[model samples]
Target: MKKWAIYVVLCILTPAIVKAQAVVADSVHMTSKKKVPKVQYGVASFYHNKFEGRKTANGEIFSQKKLTAACNTLPLNCWVRVTNIRNNRSVILRITDRMHPLNKRLIDLSHAAAKTLGYTGHGLTRVKVEYLGKTKPVELNLMEQPAQP
Candidate 1:
C-alpha cells in the first residue's frame, strides 16, 4: 500500500516538474541570446590633415588613407557601416579611435572613408551608423603551423 501511494505521488508530480524545468530552460535560453546591434544617426565629419600621423585612442597610428573612424560611443576595434544620407553612399569602417569629449558628431571618419562616402567636400554630412559587432581575432590551425621548428 505504501508503494502504491508513492507511485501515485510521483505520477502526479512528474508532469508538473517537467513543465517547470522546460520553462526555466526557455528563460535561460532567452537570456543567453546575443543582444541586438545598435544604430545611430547624426552628422559625421572627417579627420583633418594635421591628424594624419597621430596616435589614436586605441594606440594605432591615425592615417587619413585608411577606412577607420573615431566614435564617441562605439567600442574600439568594432566595425560599423556609415551611410551618407544625402547621397545614399555607404562605407564600412573600423572604429579605431574615440572622438573628443565635447564633440557632438556621431562619428569622425578618416579622409579616405569620407571620400568613399562622397562627402569630403561637404566636410560634414548626415549619416547612419550601424554597429556590426566586434572584429574577430585571427585563428591559427595546426595545419597552418610552421611544423616542428
Candidate 2:
C-alpha cells in the first residue's frame, strides 16, 4: 500500500518538476542567442503630415520622411518589415512609438513608410508585419533576399 501511494505521488509531481526545468532551460536559451521575432498581420495606417516635427511617445521628433512606425505592443526600437497585402509592396520600419490599446489600427506608419507601400492616399492598408528582432535602427535594402546558389 505504501508503494502504491508513492507511485501516485510521483505521477502527480513529475510533470510539475519537468515543466520547471524546461522553463529554466528555455530562458537560458533565449538569453544566449538572438531570436527572430514572430510575424503578425493587421491593418496599417499612416500618421498625418501634421504630426511631423512633433515629439513622439518615445521622445524622438516625428518625421514624415523617416521610416518609423507605431505598434500596439512591439518593444520600442524594434525593426519590422511591413508588407502591403494587396499589392505585395513592402517597407522596413523601426518601431519608435506605441499605439493606444483602444485604437483599432494594428500598426501606424510614418508618411514615408506609407508612401513606400503606395498607400498614403488610400489612408489604410492591410499589411503583414515580420518582426526582425532587435537591432540598431537603420534603413536596409528593401529587395528580396538573393536566392541561394
Clashes counted in candidate 1 amount to 0
Backbone clashes, candidate 2: 0
Off by over 4 Å in 2: 1-37, 136-149
Which residue pairs overlap in candidate 2's backbone? none
Candidate 2 per-residue lDDT over residues 1-149, each given as its tens digit: 99999999999999999999999999998886544458888999988778888888889999988989999767778888899999999988899988778999889999889999999889999999998877743446424456569
- Best by the lDDT measure: 1
Task: Estimate TM-scores for all models.
Answer: 0.66, 0.67
Superposed by TM-score, candidate 2 places the C-alpha of residue 54 at a distance from the truth, in angstroms, of 1.4
Listed per model in order, the count of residue pairs whose N, CA or C atoms clash below 3 Å is: 0, 0
Alpha carbon lDDT of residue 6, candidate 2?
100
Model 1 CA deviation exceeding 4 Å by range: 1-37, 136-149
